[model samples]
Target: MSVARKVVIEITSDNVCPWCYIGKKRLDKAIARAPSNLSFDVRFRPFQLDPTASPYGVPKLEAYERKFGADRVEKMIPHMKAVGEAEGIKFDYGGLIANTLDSHRLLAFAASQNKQLPVSAALFAAYFENQQNIGDRETLIEIAAKAGLDADAARAYIESDAGEREVREEVAGARQRGISGVPFFRIDGLYEISGAQDPAVFEEVFAKIAESA
Candidate 1:
């Protein structure tokens, strides 16, 4: 008799972080390629790259230019675009960058529905590939509906402050854990990996864990 080995992975990420998107893509690939005997339970925790950004949103390029300088943003874009293209992501600088608090709230609700991953992916795609403003309530409800949640319920939930406290607390917990950046992975709550690492890194870790089990 073979018993499947189960592993839990908690990813702390801000929806607007480019590196978090990249890290998620790589992690999904790694999980797909892992041994059949290993099953993964992936959950997401909240983080905020810019908590003070407006809900109305601002152009990603403009925000970057303002914060990092136009010259630096110009230098950063090409490299980010090249890296993103390698991962099959169409990076767009014209997308909106806004406070991700509402988006985080939506994700918390998705977790209860077991639709978090798809919802998260949809949000990232909307902002990074489709140039949609994820901070908008309507936009988020649309994303939730597309991710297999009921649109009306999503709208109702987003209109209220249902998960705000929990989301904020989780974000604070992540920071208290000394995670100063997005794309941080807490594997099995014991082993940790940070940044948008290569898929092979995850595969190796999974293999080691399985062997130990």
Candidate 2:
């Protein structure tokens, strides 16, 4: 029997990033294609693409256009749409907004419990699919429950100050590492994949790690 490989992949992302969604989808597809003997672990770290963003949410396209220039934003739309279509995901650009600090906290809590991957995926679905506010406590609890977590405990964690420091620390660490964008995937804590890349990229990385292990 093959020994289950121990691989730790970390991602620093926020809920509102369009490319982050695409990155996740691509990673999921890559993982699905990975060898069955390859067992690994994944964690979601904290990084606010816009740490200064208001809790009420800034305009999605407008914000991107302003930050990266209107021309670049205009160019990004078609690419983003294509990626979403490839992954069978709908790009709800208009519906994307929110601070995501609370979401980060919940992720940290889930990470502490070794449930970060599923919880983070569920939180993304809640925001992008269900058009729900991931920052809302009730919404987070529901999402956590859907991810196989305890809704009541998630609710309590959101209500309490628990895991806030860890979330902040993760954000600070990302900043210290010079991460300014979402969907930054760190493979085996060494190889870094940034933005919404093709599944082939993740496949290559996953294969390399599996071989190394």
Candidate 3:
């Protein structure tokens, strides 16, 4: 018999969403536990949790308060810190912001070259760990290069609005699917999982997909 076709996983997430980051880590771990013979293609889609964010980062603390309310964010910090520790991911929540639209566009550019996941990871590291303003064109290009994209060409593309249409299309697709949050995962383009869950959760999902094939 012919081997089963690989599944495509569509992830709709904003880089600024900490849960999205954690969710990706969990998904990675889950995929690691799946059947070796099975194959899958992961695609990160665009979702702007905060569409009104300015190009320049807003003050991290204030921005969080505005997005989720002061009390709620304050209560969540300790939990986020603990989760970060568990995942070996840093929580510089102090320096990040709510702007990720341009970051999404840059990911689209990277996707055009089949380098979306690496570029997206770099973008996440730049903003969350390195505390860089990922929305900045220069910064985004640099991250894109680190993710194996051609830096000069990426810079040019970002500056010339060459990938804007593709970015918009992805955003529209997300909207059409009724995705309002980050880290949304559609496994094999069929099974859907939302939220930044545990690595075990991803493993369970991966097994299900593999078995079904």
Candidate 4:
């Protein structure tokens, strides 16, 4: 038997993005289907879908309509909902506009504690499923605690300007790389996959990486 190949996958996404959540689920399924000889070190990177969003946020539906127009928003909803349902996610696109900066900062803090993935999932669920305002400090602290981080530490981190600069710089770097969209995946620092691609696409990429290894 050959040695298992280790691959690093860095996913640049925003918590408020429904497609990112779906992409995450598909990526998980693809990883689960990988051969035993393949190992993954997956990391979540920050990308702001709306950098100009207010910290207080606006109504989700209103924001969507304002940004994408009512007609397009109406057409996009059923599609997003269908895709989310297929991925076993119930996306409740209720009226809760979220400023994802604080959430991204929390993710950065979670990365320090090696809890990035769980915290990110919690944030996504809170925003999309539970309709919780992830922009709120209290909600974020609660989500962080639920993800196994120290609540007090998380609160303190949020109160302070701890992860702000890092998150901003990471977002800037992503933009500098010409990445204007969320759910962008960089595999083994070589291959790039954008949007909520199919599991077969992810599987094919993984297989190619494994074979090359």
Task: Name the TM-score of candidate 2.
Answer: 0.86
Q: What is the lDDT of residue 165 in candidate 2?
A: 79
Model 1 lDDT tens row, 89-159: 99987878889999999999999989999999999999988999999999999999999999998998999
Q: How does residue 69 of candidate 4 score in lDDT? A: 100
- Candidate 4 lDDT score at position 87: 94
Q: Is candidate 1 or candidate 2 better by lDDT?
A: 1
lDDT for each residue of candidate 2 in 25-60, tens digit (9 for 90 to 100): 888888889866576677777888766777666666
lDDT of 4: 0.91
Provide backbone clash counts, one per model: 0, 0, 1, 0
- Compute the lDDT of residue 196 as modeled in candidate 2: 83
State TM-scores per candidate.
0.97, 0.86, 0.91, 0.96
Model 4 spans with C-alpha error above 4 angstroms: 1-3
lDDT computed for candidate 3: 0.80
| Model 4 lDDT per residue over 2-90, tens place | 77899999999998988899999999999999977899988999999888898887889999999899999999999988888899998
Candidate 3 local lDDT, 56-118, one digit each (tens): 877788887887899999898888889888987887865647467778888888888999989
